[model samples]
Target: MAVGARLTPDVLELDPAAATDRIVAELRTIVGKTLRRRGAVLGISGGIDSSVTCALCARAFGPERVLGVLAPETDSETETLRLSHVVVSTFGVPYVVENITPILAAARCYERRDETVRELVPAFTSGWKLKVVLPDVVGNDLYRVLFLVVESPDGRQERHRLTAEQSLAIVAATNFKQRTRKMIEYYHADRLNYAVAGTPNRLEYDQGFFVKNGDGAADVKPIAHLYKTQVYRLAEYLGVPEEIRVRPPTTDTYSLPQSQEEFFFSLPYQKLDLCLYAHNHGLRAEAVADAVELSVADVERVFRDIEQKRRTTRSLHMSSRLVEPVAEIDLSDA
Candidate 1:
């Protein structure tokens, strides 16, 4: 079998028209017919995944039936709400803006996160910004270590290796933001009698990049099966605003501007996409390295990291466990 030489950039390309039609049809069936919901509700994050998911939703259920929700917190990028508006308008879907700053504040989300940061850097204060990142997987480092990056009020910056306890504290505090936003999403969904739509792409989904009971909880997920790159292709075909279509992927969950690659994926979406596709299709490391323009060693490292994340984050994909299985009625069949 040919190794990586046979793989090309177009390896994941699909007929956008067909993909859109299929997704829209399935969304209708799942959200409407099966879920017993009249419409769909999803948070628009000003990211490609959410934008494309919103547009597909508009096509599946009439624009009027789909509700686009914008839930931005204190640390959210300034451009997030603006770009989210662009998405809702371009798709002609109605949306509600729920500024979650007050909610986060009430829950002490910022306070707790800052307290943890201060434990590491005593000078951390109001004007300081921070983000947590992992070591570059594509580099010589084989071990994955999380580092804290903080920008001082006066523009100085520092990186510090976090203890496991410190990392857990900071992450646990930051999780309030996602859980809060998810609460709002569900509130709207319940009031509207619509299903909550999740926007995670295949890579994020497969790697467990979502918060449990937060972004991870959704009534229907339309784009979970598509690669990040494929989501971009669908964005273009669906007429997602050029601004959102071109914006780089971001966590937007951090106070400091953080790209999704630096924060989680470790590799840019394009390369990660190729590596993931190769691994899934049984492509060898040498072939993947050549296809993605990375060294063979880097490809192997990425493949290992992929498996590692799968093992570590497997619970994110699972439902609540019980001592014994409970059989439920199939409403669709009923």
Candidate 2:
């Protein structure tokens, strides 16, 4: 299956308002049933989804009780930090900024400075080859390769490597950052007797767009059902900063300032989500194109992607199983 299959839709007809309302009601129940206090803890990335989640948390539990944690990696952009602060201030909630550079540095040192590069040796023939060199102090611990590709043009071949440590440092660095934030948030939540709020929306969740045990870990999720578009609407309703609501969403993991849509789908989120919704709900590709006013070819492409994602997600789900259940369980005569 292709990389972004999980993000495409089999059908394209989710009721955003109904989904948002249902999630809000569920969030309220979680606040009342799970949280002993009025405030909640959420990681605010300054993106629309997190901002919307934080806003909803504040609305449900009160602004004073909601604590927003801004966990920025060393390579995080200034704009992200600014937006995070904006959201926190808008809601009148307490906020904290924690940098995780030191932890990443330590992890790099433990793994050795040139681990990824060294691992690249087997993939290359024993000949003149190019490799990315790292500083001695950071070694291998500070850098991680996100992908390695061999490209050839007119018989001139080159191997290119992308590193999560340096190029996409925010990815690895921020994964730990998020996990650490959760740990701290959990501590604060325990002390304050509140719930730790999750900030992922349905778009991200359907795409499996989070680190499994990192940002995906949450005690309560305030905006899990809303799609990307619906989150923007709610953000407007809740008075989120205009800059944040209008800005394209980015993970801010790399120096290039890449958004999730650019990195994953190579299309705008608005277009991608619409295509996904139509395809996922069993709409004919032509019909979807008509509904969204997109080209038929585009809709067909999205259809193919959705089918791939369904197969891939199913495989992943099966592979993650730790124990095999009985192949056949007798249910008769129970």
Candidate 3:
């Protein structure tokens, strides 16, 4: 789609300094006017999106008023926690750490997902974590089959074709992580009278990268409109630790190594951002292909995948529908 001008390299450009100031003001207004909350609370996962969102929250609500909760599970990277602490301390945001492994354990998330994984790979054992990935399309035909990748602590790996039933059961079980984190965040929010801040940037939010009512549940999503690239720029402008600014984005959900690109999108985030922007602006596949340096066919494939996921996840993005109002009573003295 034409942006009504020649599409330059600056099409997706972000001015970090100015973006920071503008988002800070927007956050302040949301908390002060919309939510009427005294503060913001969030789960800081050490990713650029969360780091920038937390920094903005602290700037808007003061370090003392913002609570940064570190929710890590057994598979969580140690560096995730370390970087999380760096941001919390760097901003002096009041912090809490919750090890979420037990919660998942109690909810039978591990056993259930493992049970499903073992159906495909009987060698699945206690020392391993599993990640499920969908096969990519080539040429005019895309593969719709799913694959389960298992890795052991000593770094052994195996790939298995996963049945749809297994994938469904596995996802249903593992989604407890995000939902559990949301429950913890809200427990504090209830007591502190703060708004739970969601940290999804435009790409993740628009593409349904979040679990419904889990990581997707939040009182305020301050960065949902910014693209992944823009979030990094804000990280740099806000002095987010250089390590964090440079950290590769990961889903960080699986026990084994997995990146957001591998888990969901067909392309890396840098390229995907250009494709998403082009797609949103009504550009043809060829136009996006030129911008992100991909073949026209690849751009078309990404566009189709984007539409498929957006359609698939529409249910996750909706509110409950009711035929009649529950709270609005018709009879005054019934």
Candidate 4:
């Protein structure tokens, strides 16, 4: 409930020109002084965060020093792959195409996900893509239920409540995607002695919209402090392809295309970004509702939902806890 009350309206909408300069400079500093690495490596998902992250890396380290790895699996959207290449070509960054379908198949991620989906919707077939969503939990509600939303090739959609077990199975399965991608990113980074760059914008990072030790793992998160709207503005200024720029935010992790809203957030990114900022700034729900044109109840729901997400996903922000030190190592040893 207390994310702090900071009046940061100007931070919500960025001046791309100034941002580019500051980010690029900060990137150079982080890369040169902090990471002690020659270059940076990242997975290019063709999303706004990935696009802007790569662009900043290119500016800081040059296209040659930035390696964009395109790791796509069977469930990934075609446009995501297509636009990934666009980003690499636009930035003239060196890249490698690594199809991860075989790896995912080996891991049985899709099979596990399918079995769980069929448990809920017996008619679920190969043509169906499933997305799990959680309803708003607010105001000391101890229990929060999860839901499963699926789409078929014929454009039919279904939504139903999911048992905790069903949700866990699906998540445990699909999470392999993020972990696998991170593995590939690290492989390349290790070979090149480069730091693994993270692509989470402020909204995703604050809301815990990443997987633990998966997409959540990064050597450096250059855009972790910028909101979603700011990331888009930076994308446009960085010359991200117009098609990619205008593409609606999506998970792109499922067989059927799904927007980020249907999968997670209740409101659109722009509105959500403002609401989140306002909430963080200690604005009352009624004031935020008037600003974003929603009812006070709805705004309060969003605020509480934000709190719920931050609470549940808190562990993803942490390192693995150890009960005790293996050997009381000294800090000066390193």
Report lDDT per candidate.
0.90, 0.63, 0.84, 0.84
- Report the C-alpha lDDT of model 1 over 1-334, residue by residue, as the tens digit: 4543656668889999999999999998988788889998999998999999999999999999999889988788889988998889899999999999998899898899889899889998888999999988876565777899999988899999999988888889998988888899999999999999999999999999999999898998999999998999999999997888889999898889999888889988999999999889888888777778899889999999999999989998997677865578333473
Question: Taking the tens digit of each residue's C-alpha lDDT, what string does model 2 give over 40-141?
Answer: 788888888888888777766678878888877655788888889888988888987777667766766313423443455344332322222223211122
Whole-model lDDT, candidate 4?
A: 0.84
In model 2, the worst 10-residue window by lDDT is 131-140
| Alpha-carbon runs more than 4 Å astray in model 3 | 1-6, 137-140, 152-154, 326-334
Q: Predicted candidate 2: what Cα RMSD to the true structure?
A: 10.1
Best by lDDT: 1
104-160 per-residue lDDT for model 3 (tens digits): 998999899888887877778887777878665435464576688988778878888
Clashing residue pairs, backbone N/CA/C < 3 A, model 3: 1-283, 1-284
Residue 181, model 4: lDDT of: 92
Candidate 2 residues lying further than 4 Å off, grouped into runs, are: 1-24, 34-38, 109-174, 290-294, 310-334
Off by over 4 Å in 4: 1-11, 134-144, 151-157, 325-334
TM-score rank order? 1, 3, 4, 2
lDDT of 2: 0.63
Cα displacement (Å) at residue 304, model 3? 0.9
Q: How accurate is candidate 1 locally (lDDT)?
A: 0.90
